[model samples]
Target: MSSFLTLSIVQSALELGCIYALVALALFVSFSLLNIADLSTDGCFTLGCAVGAVVTMAGHPFLAFFAAMAAGVASGFITAFLQTKMGVQSILAGIIVNTGLYTINLMVMGFSSNINLFNTNTIFSMAKELSESEVYRSWYKIIIVVCIVLLVCVFLAWFLNTSLGLSIRATGDNEYMVRASSINPGFTITVGLCVASAMTALSGAVLGQYQKSCDINYGTGQVTIALASLIIGESLIKKGSIFKRVIFVVLGSCLYRFIVAIALRMNLPAEALKLVSAVIVAIAISFPYLKEKAGFYKHRRDVMRQASKNV
Candidate 1:
């Protein structure tokens, strides 16, 4: 491929990576920090997109951001309420909310499955307007996504150190300990899920605006993608401080996107595309355990050999 073509592909990957990083960060908040799987992510994401698209259609692209987050917070609250107040299991609560959101998302979009925003004003369109005289005009999406991702990362780093943040982490680490400390695990979980869902919704808003369209199916399997990216990111920065680990999640998102881009270019059989994602996720999830097992076997073999020599 030509240099220009390569650069184009890389740029596409970067845009995708940056967008997905927001979801990974969302997962980080719930899965890593709050110890909640929050299976409602896929539905919550589409909810944001639908809500954002509808709101932004009314000539207030900026307001769409907060509106989507508010929708997300509501989704999180419902799920949390089920878990905390109704005594539903965490996973079951997520499933219940996720299924319920399908209708809710459709309702938000006026019972439509798709919304077209080709002529609408979006953050990217604004960026393009400002960068009309600059070479960065073509890269407006990347610029917007990177800025949003950075802001989320910074905000999360700050939030993760606050008293509430510490309580959330403590609840994640050990709910029993949190209860004994007079801190409410239920309260911490509710806050954590709300925050995570907000981030997820923000990402969906960005994606909807960037694509200039919203489709009901846009959020399918997003949780799996975010989980893979999260595992890959945490592996890359295994020993980092909280801030470093959080930032690396963005890097991992980009890296995951790059891997997918390359795979797509390889012209894999159409039937195998889904399988490819599954394999990637499986590797990301199991590689560490496999590595440790391999080392253990190697050490056992070496010990056996030494014992034979001594005998």
Candidate 2:
């Protein structure tokens, strides 16, 4: 128990949570706002990692972010084009893009399965050099990740309220209504997906730098994790403005990480973490429905008690 409460453990969980919060935010945009289930998230995430790793290894750490985002935009564009122009279903389009991205990712990694950044300079390392204090150095990773998460939250708030953003939202709510209002649902979807994928790629870019390595399997189950985080956030913040909702998405990611960290501390094998994630996802997905059912049953029971008293 005491080991679980260590500052190092907490910091690690928080840093990872913040990094993954970007993925959650991406899902929030595409899944919740735009009503699109992008199954390419896992592949897109690895694409970001591969691109970022290659760029950083080439002596341009900062450029890796933009490069990764560009790659993500391209991936999203292909998926969108398939759905909008090639008459592919959204799910099928995502699957096709995802499958293709695996080959591309391997090529980006020079046909290798992994890339190590053991001695490479990354954004985290750059931040660490800005301060001389040991405490500052120790917390640099968390500071950078938190700052990025905050910036992304602010961006989501501002962007989602814009005219174009509103169009995307409306397109998700009712494609016919948006089309009747002279807005192109296809265009809105393309823009929304591209933006969301950029965020997801950014998350992967950060994670690659933080861990100082990129693995082919690093992105596996990313969509499930992001979906679980988004659903957990929505369950926690049932009614709020968009900004508040986005903020809670970060919180949810942190909470999920804390749970996993605790499980690890309790002697659970690493292999079991996937099962844990699956369980969390199932619970998060079903929570709202279960809550409504419980409420209905309670209401009926109360009504029966009142009628019995009157009789």
Instruction: Give the Cα lDDT of each candidate.
Output: 0.89, 0.90
Give the per-residue Cα lDDT of candidate 2 at 46: 95
- Which is the leading candidate under TM-score? 2
lDDT of 1 by residue, 109-182 (tens): 99999999999999888778874565677677788888889999999999989998888889888877887898
Ten-residue region with minimum lDDT total, candidate 2: 1-10
Could you give the C-alpha RMSD of every candidate to the true structure, in order shown?
2.0, 1.4
Model 2 has an lDDT value of 0.90
Residue pairs in candidate 2 whose N, alpha carbon or C atoms collide under 3 angstroms: none
**Candidate 2 wrongly placed segments (more than 4 Å):** none
User: How many clashes in each structure?
Assistant: 0, 0
Could you give me the TM-score of model 2 versus the true structure? 0.96
